[model samples]
Target: MKVYLSVDMEGVTGLVDAEDVQPRGRDYERGRVLMTEDANAAVRGAYDAGATAVLVNDAHGPMRNLLPDLLDPRATLIKGRPKPMGMIEGLTREYDAALCIGYHARAGVLGVLSHSFMGHEIEDIWLDDQVTGEIGLFHATAHAYGVPVALLTGDDTACAEMTAWDPSVATVPVKYAKDRFAAQLVPVPEAQAAIRTTTHQALANLPALTADRARTRRLAVRWQNASVTAHLTAIPGVLRQDDRTVTVEADMPHLYRLFNLFLRVATAVTTNPPYC
Candidate 1:
């Protein structure tokens, strides 16, 4: 069996501050080590569960956060950006299951370092009117290729959110969020152990964990500022729903591409200097 692992930074063991996730932060190195170890644990678990191959995708800022040299030798790493598929890149029908590591809750929700895709640029994302986060978005993308999300590891809120979506999905909570940047953490060793155990169990039950396909997919993105909507409206098939929201009707592949484009454009506009 083959497994795909999408790993992010914020929800890794003991990470409760945004600074820890950035490359320039004082604790950034420590954060990377923790992220790598957690991922290694998951990779180890996948192998233990009879997985013949595993691909680990670094799905955080810049998409190059994971240290390739430090990663488990058994799994191949997918790094860098500009890929058509963001988190679930390289995913296809050949994979038996997908594992989401170090994911947080949706924007405006309580989770350790929680934010949807872009922190301040996107306020919320809705799929068929359901409030969806990274987990929902990436899970849908994986599902499109017939890969089931068997295991997820993150903070308490992220685990709760995933459980609500699919009760059978195995989840390991590395921390309990007091707020966005504050959390009651699980020790690194414990978190890693939990992730390994849960991953093994999840893969063991892969047949039952496969997700059902959505009948229809309509993605609605609500930006934090109205200015971001101006850029998105220019995309073909993207409709301006309101000053701060845009809606797109497409399947998972197309929708994922549009979302990637949306993030690039929105990030560019939001970071540029204003001209009066």
Candidate 2:
């Protein structure tokens, strides 16, 4: 079986606050290793579920979180920013399934390390008029490509949040968020075990969704910070809603690419400086 994994840093084990997730931050290196280890656990699980090949995308900021030498040698890594699919680079209809590793919920979801792309610029997202998060948007894109999101690993809120969008997608709760930036730790080994178990369950019940269309879909974002939203909604198809949320209509099945572009524009506001 072929599987595609999208890996992010925030929900990885042993991480907290921006210091551990930001590139110039003091603890970012240690957080990166933790992120890589969690990804390997998912890799091990995918193999157990008969995944013959897995491609992992470094989905975090700058997209260079994984240590190449320490990654699971059995899989290939797609690293760097400005890539075609962004977080889910290698995804295609040819793949049997997809997995999201170390993911978190959108901003204000109480998930550990939770924040939408470009932080506050993304207040919320909607697909087909239903409120959604990055996971929902990603899953929709994967579905458009004829792939099922078999497994997901993240904080309890992340797991709970996904349950609403995809009840059947296997989920492993590696941490319980006490609040936005804090979580109760689950031993590293324990979290790994939960991830493996849930992955097996996910494989057993893959959703029967068709994936033979010409990558057409819509993704709209609502930004809490109006200063940023004003600019994004100014794009041709983008419509500004109220003062906080900006709606962008995109039909590209390659949503990640569009997502990458939005990140830059949303952060262009002078008041909300980037890297602060």
Candidate 3:
């Protein structure tokens, strides 16, 4: 079976602040190592569960955080930006299962390094009228391709977010959030072990899983600035709901790609860092 892993950085083990995940931060080098190790744990687990092929997408800032040289050679890696699909760039209906690694809670939540796709620029997002962050958006997109999200690894709150979205999916919490930038962390060894074990179990039971059928996906974005909305409305089919909110309805993957473009536009117009 083929497995797809979308790995983010904020929810990796022991990472509790922006300095840990941002590329220029002092500890960013160390953070990359931790991120790769966590990913490696999942990769190893996928192999343990009888996966014939695995694809790992570096789904964090710049989409190039995971070190290719350090990654498990058994799995291929998807890195870099301008990817149309963003986090789930390499995903398709052919994969047996998908896993989200090192994700965090949505914006307005009190989890470590918590924010939606674009830091503070995106105030809120809705998929089919349900509030969503990166986790839900990616999950729905994967489901659209006939792939079930079998396992997720993140902090306690991120695990809860996934659980709220789908109770059957397994989760491994690498840390417990004390605040947005603070958390009671699991030791690196322990967190990696848990991720591996859970991933193995989740995929081992993949036969019992079924993907949600594709549907018309509706997306609503509430930006932090009205200027962002002004640029968004210029896109065909994008409807302005208010001064700072815009809504669009499209099928899966297209809606996901359009949202990526929205972030690109927001990035062009805003100067705010991804975190406060």
Candidate 4:
């Protein structure tokens, strides 16, 4: 069996503040180590569960946060950006299952370091009128290829979000958020152990955990800045919903392409704001 692991930074063990996740922050180095270790734990768990191959995608900011030297030797890593699928880049139908590691809750939620993709730029995302986060969006992408998201690890709110999206998915909550920047955390070793155990169990029940493809696909992105939304409306199929939101009508595959395009445009506009 083959497994794909998408790993992000904020929800890793012992990470509770912005300082830990940013590259120039004082704790950034330690955060990278923790991120790598958590990913290694997941790779180890996948191997233990009879997976013949595992691929790990660095899904955090900069997309190069995981320390290659410390990553488990058994798995191949997909790092850096401009990839077609962003977070779920390396995913394909050949994989038996997928795991989302170190993911936090959606933006505006009470979870450790919680935010959706592009923390400050995107206010929220909705799929078919259902409020969803990065996890849910990526899960939908994986489902399009018939890959089940068997295991997820994060803070309590992230776990709760996944459970609500699909009850059969196995979740390991390494922390309980006290607020956006504070949490009651599980120790590093304990969190790693829980991830390993839950991953194994999830793979064992992979057949039962398979996610169903959505019958309809309509995505709405609410931007933090109205101008960003206006800029995105330039895309052929994107429709302006309001000053700060745009809606797109597309199937799963096309939606993924449009989403990537939106991210690229949004990032560009965010960094180089136009004077009104």
Candidate 5:
């Protein structure tokens, strides 16, 4: 069987600082190494559970966080950003199952270094009225692709958040957060072991994927501040529905395009004084 893995840094064991997840920050290399180890553990688990191949997508920051040479030889890695599918880029109907590694909880999730995707600008995101994180959004997309998300790795709060999506997927809590920027980390080996076990269980109990074959859906964006809301209303039909929110009607393919456009606009707003 083939499996796809989406990996991030904030949810990796022992990492408590945002700097650790970005290339420009101190200790980022160290964080990448830890993130790689966690990915390897999942590779090991999937292989043990009879998977013949696995693909890993580096979904954080530049999306190039994982070291190509250090990753498991049995799996391929998809890096860089602006992918049409984002976290689930390389995934397809041919894949058997999927996994999400280093997944922090949703934005405003206390005790975890939590923020929704594009944390600096996105205040909150909702799908059909229910607030969700990247994990949930990606999970829905994965379901649409006919791939079940088999495992999720992160701090305890991240695991708790996953329950809002797929409660059956195995969860590996590699650390316990004290707050958004700090946590009590488990030793690397312990984290790896837990991830391995969860990976195995996830594949072992992997159920048929749930995909929304429906062609149309709504994705609403809620920015942290009004300025951000003003920035997006420029898109036709994307108007301020509320003080801090805007709603867009999208089919699956259009949804992907809108999401990227939104990401770009958000990134532009926060561009530093050098650009300003």
Candidate 6:
């Protein structure tokens, strides 16, 4: 079996604030080490479950947080930005399963470091009118490629979000949210052990995995700034909804690509730092 791991920093064990995940913060270096260790746990679990190959993506801000030297040697890493698929960049139908490691909840939620794709630019997103965040988008995109999301790790609220989206998928919460920047964190070693064990168990039930048949999906986003929304209307088929919203229709994978382009457009028109 082949496995794909999409790892983000905010929900990694022990991280609860922007300072932990952002590059400029004093604790960011330590945060990267913790992020890498969480990913290594998933890699180890995949191998233990008879995986022939594993691919890990550093899906955090700037897409450069993971420390390559410390990652498990058994997996290949996909890092850096401009990836059309964003967090789920390396996913394909060829893989048996995908794991969303260290993912947080959507913007406006009470979870450790919770926010949408952009820190504050994107207010909310909808696929076929269903509200979703990074976790939902990642699951939809992976399912589009005929790969099931077998495991996820995050704070308690993030775990609940995934369960509400799809109850069968396994989740391991490393922290319990008290507020956006505060949580009762699990010790690093204990969190890593739970992640490893849950991943192994999730992959063991791979035969039950099935891909979503729906391909065409309507994508919409509500931005904080009207200028950013207006800029996105320049794209063909993108319709302006009032001043701060835009909607578009496209097939899976392609739709995901368009969403990434929308984010780039938003970035060009705004200078707000994420999670500020």
Task: Tell me which of candidates 3 and 4 scores higher on lDDT.
Answer: 3
Clash number for candidate 4: 0
lDDT of each: 0.86, 0.79, 0.92, 0.87, 0.82, 0.91
Please give the distance, in angstroms, between residue 119's alpha carbon in candidate 5 and its true position after superposition.
Answer: 2.2
**Backbone clashes in model 4, listed as residue pairs:** none
- Per-residue CA lDDT of model 2 for 153-223, tens digit only, reads 88888888778878878888888898777889899888887777777667767777787456555666776
lDDT of 3 by residue, 151-231 (tens): 999999999999999998999999999998899989999999999999999998864445454467789999989999999
Instruction: For candidate 4, write residues 1-276 as lDDT tens digits.
Output: 999999998889889888898888899999999999999888988988999999999998889999888999889999998888888888887889989999989987878877778876788899999998888887788887788889889999999999998888999989899988899989889999999988988998886334344555999999888988888888898999999999998767568778988988888878732111
Report model 6's TM-score to 2 decimal places: 0.97
Candidate with best lDDT: 3
TM-score (all chains, Cα) for each model? 0.95, 0.90, 0.97, 0.95, 0.92, 0.97
Which runs in model 2 stand beyond 4 Å of their true positions? 212-217, 250-256, 270-276
lDDT of 3 at 113: 91
Order of all candidates by lDDT, from best down to worst?
Answer: 3, 6, 4, 1, 5, 2
Give, for candidate 5, the lowest lDDT window spanning 10 residues.
267-276
Better of 2 and 3 by TM-score: 3
Identify the runs in model 4 with alpha carbons over 4 angstroms from their true place: 208-216, 272-276
Pairs that collide, model 6: none
TM-score of predicted structure 2: 0.90
lDDT of 3: 0.92
lDDT of 5 by residue, 100-168 (tens): 999988877784668877765677888778888887877777777778888899999988888768788
lDDT digits (tens) for residues 97-139 of candidate 6: 9999999999888788888989988889998999999999888
Query: C-alpha displacement of 232 in model 2, angstroms?
Result: 3.1
Query: What lDDT is obtained when candidate 2 is compared to the true structure?
Result: 0.79
